[model samples]
Structure formats: structure tokens, C-alpha cells
Target chain A: MIEIKGLVVRYKTVEFKFDDYKFKKNMISIISGRNGTGKTTLLKSLSSLIEYEGNIKVNGEITYNSQEPILFNRSTYENIVYPLRIRNLDLNLYKEKIDKYTRVLSIDHLLNENALKLSSGEKMKVSIIRSIIFNPDIVLLDEPTTHLDLESIVELTTLIKELKNELTFIIVSHNSSFVEELKDEEYRLGGNHVYS
Target chain B: MIIESTMKAVELLFSFDSEIYTIIFLSLAISLLATATASFFGTILGILISISDFKLKRFTKKIVFTFMGIPPVVMGLVVLLLITGPFDGMNLLFTKSAMYIAQTLLVLPIIVGNIIISSEKTQKKILETATTLGANKYHKITLLIKEIKPFILMSVILGFSRALSEVGAVMLVGGNIKNDTRVMTTYIALNNSMGEYSMSIAMGIILLLIAFVLHTLLARFRGDFYD
Candidate 1:
């Protein structure tokens, strides 16, 4: 579970104050707003990627995958397996999970291809798979649907729904259809204040 | 005269004339070691400064840029004073070690400055992304080093070029002593001053050859990483 109190994020001349809220474990929560409405800012603050004033209490591990998706200059398989390798986890233990995710995303064949050569949508898929492969307690995804096509978006939405039972998700997206499909708690932000 | 010198330069290169070979080897050994040492430590300092945010950040960059433009003659003089000061009794002056120290000091800023610029270009996104992914400081630094390796390679090569082609600093610090401290650049200057045009021109050709080889290697390395 994640709890927030008096969350205030300040940038140059603007400020955003989020209402106190609690996000239950093993659920999908969507934060939606128009462009430049601080949707990404709020998500970043929650993930502790940006500086914020307030208290955020998170129960377990959390990881964030940005919208732009940073990919290493290596093969896709290497990029996906990087976090595990760095953390010294046994690759054999995650082989089944890797197979399932890659097969679902239809990226198993492209695993050996150079990640830098991948198109934006394909790179986004690779990044998403890489981020969640470790199975953190909470995942913050910012604009995950930006480069994804209709088909990939549907596939990702399905995957998120299935995984929500095992971990928590805090997503920032402008896609109404994607939001409608998940149908979890929603927080709408406007200027300096947020509404639930 | 030009044709004769060119032929002599070719013969000296092919036959590996002992005197010329010794000079080339000394020059290469000193310059390569200086470049390697400077690149190892200087680039680490540069990468650390670039990734960090602190109050003195702008001031530190300004200082590095200023040092990058430092005159070689002035650097040589500074080094000469240091060696001839408390360490005067050590007899480091007119020695290859003195030249190595001078050249290292002269090229360190070049290596560090280029690293700072390249790290600014490449490490920002990677650093931020790594932070978001819950990477610790060590992991982030390692990832950053791996990512900007090509730029680092370019910087080290540039430093070597500077060290190899340097004349003013090495001459002042090394005194261009015969056989023991003579390097390619100093040898060329000495021969030219003595009106030994053929030998000077030969050394010039050898220097050009060295530069060409370095550039070709850098190009091949870039291809492997970039492609």
C-alpha cells in the first residue's frame, strides 16, 4: 500500500498540491489530466523521481519506467535482462516469466535484434517488459501508450489487468479507451490542486 | 633535396634505423603512458562532475575550460619550477620522467574537458532513467561509463594526439637531451635548428604516419560501436 499526505511539488513558478490519498496494494490506479496538467509530474513525485514536499509512505519496492523509454546500445534480450543481471538474480528463475511476457507481446523473435535499431513502439514494448520483469511491488508508468499502436496498446492493457492482481500500478495516460478498460480509481489534476 | 629527404625517411622507416627507432619508441612510450594515465583519472573526475549537481558546478566547469586553453609553454614553465624547487636535488629535470609529467599535465584538461562535454550530451537521459529504475549510485556510474565509451575513446585519442604533437612543453621540461630525452617533436626542432633538414623532415613524416594510424584505429572503433 502507498499513502500520501499534503503532497506539494514546486517548479519554477508553478506548484501542484495533491489531495491526501491511499492506494491499496494489488490494484490499478490511473491519474488522468489534459496536456501540461502535471499528470506526469504527480506520477514522478509519487515514484520519488522528482523532489517533492510531503510524506509518501510506500510498503514495498517501486520502480519507474519513463515515457521516453531508455534503451541501452545492445540487443533487446540484453536490455531486458540487464536489471536482473545487475541485481545478481538467477536468470534461470525468470526464464518462464520472460517467455510468457515476450510471447504475449510478440517480441520473442526480436530479442536477438539490436535494441537501438528497434522502432519507437517496439522499443517501448521492450522497455515495459524490462521494467516489470523483476516484479516490483509498485510500478509507475508515464505515458506508456505514447508510441504504442492500437494492437500493442490492447495487448499491454490486457497484460496490466492480469498483473494488477499481483502488483500495484500507477499509470499516467491520456488514452480514454485504455483508461476505460482498466476502470480503477482515478485522480484528476488541474493547475495547483488535484481532485479524486 | 626534398626527394632525397623523402627517400631517406622511407628508408629510415623500413629499415628501422636504431637511432630513429629509439627516438620513436621513447616518444610513443612517454606520450601513450601520459595519455592513458590522464584519461583514466581525468575522465572519472569529469564524469562525476557532469552527473552531479552542486553549488560549484558552474565554477568547476569554467575552471576546467580555462585550464583546457592553458598555454603549453606556461605549463612547461610551471612544471619546471616544481621539479627544480623542492625536488631539484632529485635530478628530474632533463629526464624522460619530467617530460611525461609535463605532457600529462598539459593533456589532462583536454581529456577531461571533452569528457565533460560528451557526458553532458549522453549521460543526462541515462542518468535520469537509471535513477527512475531504482539504480544505486555505483550501478548508475557503471552504466554511464559503458554508454559514453565511444566518446571516452575519442577523448583519450585526442589527448594522445596533443601529447604526441606537443613541442614547447616537452622541450622546456626535457631540455631535448640526446638519445635519453629526445622525442619526435623535439628531435624535429633540433634537426631543423642545426640545418639538418633531411632528418627533421623524416621525423615529420614519421609523426604524420603515427597520426594517420591513430585516426584509422579510432574510425574502426567508432564503426563497431555506432553501427
Candidate 2:
């Protein structure tokens, strides 16, 4: 479960005001807004990427994947293993889970290839797989399906649905259909809300 | 006359004279060492400057940016005076160590400035993601460093090229001592004074070749970076 109360963000000439909100455990919440409406900024602020004034009470760990996928020069396998390594989990313990996710994402073949050489769709898949490998309490994804093809997008939506039982998913996207397919609740920002 | 001089320069290079090789080797070694040290430290400082919110951060960046345009001769003169006057007891003036110090100072600003630009460009997103993930300060820094590895490598190469080709500051500090402080640029100067035009031209060609090799390596690395 997560609770965000009175979040305020100010970035050079722009201000974002987020009111108190609560997210239920193991539920998918989608935030929909047009471009320049502070959707990405709000998502990042929720992820703790931006400095904001708020009280975010998260019961467990949170994992965040950015809108633009970030990949190192290493192979896909190594990229997926980064967070696991940071958490100090034994690699052998998660080998089966990693293998399953890679195969499900159709990235098993690209595991040995340098991640920087992958296409945008492939990189996004890898980034998503990396974010969820360790089963964090909450997972924040910003436009994860933007670069994906129709088939890949469907597959990802299915995967998110399957994993929703174990993790809270907060997604920020402009694709309303995709959000409708996954989220039980939705919120739209940037229409007459300001903080005094 | 030009053709004859060029031919003689080629001959001197092929001959591999001990004095000429010594100068070439020393220049490459010292410049590479200085660049390596400066780039390592400068990248860390640049990342710190990019991420941290502090008073004087803007002023510090402005000072470093201004230092990037310092003339090599003026930088040389400053180091020379400092070593010979205020800290004269150390007697670093006209020494290889003094040359290293000057070259380090000359290239540090470039390294720091390049890294600052690169770090600022990418650090915001990485920091945001890491923070949202509840990553501590150490994790944030490590992840950021990984993200900017390619730019950091570029900065190091730039610093290396700048230090390797420098002549004025090194000449002022090293004093072009035979068999000791003589580096490629200073040796070229010495050979010219002795009317060994062939030797000077040979060293110049070698310097050009080294520069070419350095750039080629950097280009290859950049290709890998983008891939």
C-alpha cells in the first residue's frame, strides 16, 4: 500500500500540485494526461526522482522504470541483474526467475548481446524486466509501451496483469486503451488545481 | 629545400636516435599520466557539482569554465612563479614533476567542464529513478557514474589529447634539460636551436602520428559507446 499526501513540486517557473491520494495493495493505478501536463514529472516525483514536498508512506520497496529506457554497455543479462546486485541478493537464487522473465519478454536470445545495441522496443522490454525481476512492493512505469509494437504491447499488458497480484503498478501513459485494459482507477491532471 | 628537409626528417625517424626516442617516450608517459589523474578526479568533482544543490555552485562552475580558456603560456608562467617563489624550497621548477603539475592544471578544467555538461545532461533522470526506488546516496552516485561512463571516457580522451600536444607550459617548467626533462615538444625546440632541423621535423611527425592514433582510439570507443 502507498499513500501520497499534499505533494508539491516546483521546477524553474513551473509548479505541480498533487492532492492527497491513497493506492490500494496489489492494484494497478494509471495516470493519464496530455503532453506538457506534468504527467512524467508527477510520476518521477512519486518515484522519488524529483525533490518535492510530500509525505509518501510506502509499506515496502518501490522500483521505477523511466519513460526512456536506460541501458548500459553490458549484455542484457547484466543489465537485468543490476538491481538484484544492488540489493545484494545471490544471483543463483534468482536464476530461474530471470530466465522465465527473459523468455516471456522474448529477450532470452538477446541476453548475451550488448544492451546498447538493442532496438528501442527491445531496450524497453529489458528495462521493464529489470524493474520487476526482484518483485518490489510498487513498480512505477512511465510509458513502457511507447516504443513497442502492437503484439509486444499486448504481451506486456498481459504480463502486467499477471503480475498485478504480487506488485502494485503505477503507470503514466497517454494510451487510454492500454490504461483501461490494466488499471482499476484513473486520474487526469492539469485542469484547475493549484496550491496556496 | 622543403622536400629535402622532409626527406631528412623521415630518415631521422627511421634511424630512431636514443635522444629523440627518450624525449618522445617521456612526453607521452608524463602527459598520459597527468591526463589520467586529472580526468579521474575531475569527473568525480563534476558529478558532485552537477547533482548537489549548494550556495556558490554557480560561481564555482563559472570559475572552472573561465579557467578552461587559460592560455598554456600563462598557465606555465603561473606555475613557474609559484614553484620558484612562494614554494621555492621544493625546487619543482624545471623538473619533470613540475611539467606534470602544469599539464594537470591545464587539462583539469577541460575534463571537469566536459564531465559537468555530460553529467548535468543525464543525471537528473537517473537520480529521479534511483530516488523513487528508494536508493541511498551511494546507489544514486554509482548508477549515475555508470550512466555517464561514455561521456567520462570522452572527457578523458580530450584531456589526453590536450596534455599530449602541449608545449609552452611544459617547456617553461621542464627547462628542456637533456636526458631528463626533455619531452617531444621541448626536444623539437632544442633540435631547432642546434640546427638539427631533420630531428625536429621527425619529432613533429611522430607527435602528429600519436595524435592521430589517440583520436582513432577515441572514435572507436565512441562507436562502441553508441552501439
Candidate 1 C-alpha error for residue B216, in Å: 2.2
* DockQ value for model 1: 0.65
lDDT of 1: 0.87
lDDT by residue (B78-189, candidate 2, tens digit) is 9999999998999898899999999999999999998889889878766765565456789888888888888888889888888988789999998989899989888888
> What is candidate 1's lDDT per residue for B1-227, written digit by digit as tens?
88988787777677878889899999999999999999988989989889999999999999999988888889999999999998899899999899999999988999889989989988878877777666789999999888888888988988899999989999999998888999999999998898888888889998898899999988976886778
DockQ of each: 0.65, 0.50
Off by over 4 Å in 1: A193-196, B221-227
Residue-level lDDT for A43 in candidate 2: 73
Model 1 chain B poorest 10 in a row by lDDT: B126-135
- State the lDDT at A122 in candidate 2: 98
Docking class for candidate 1 = medium
Question: What TM-score does each of the candidates earn?
Answer: 0.95, 0.91
Query: How does each model score on lDDT?
Result: 0.87, 0.85
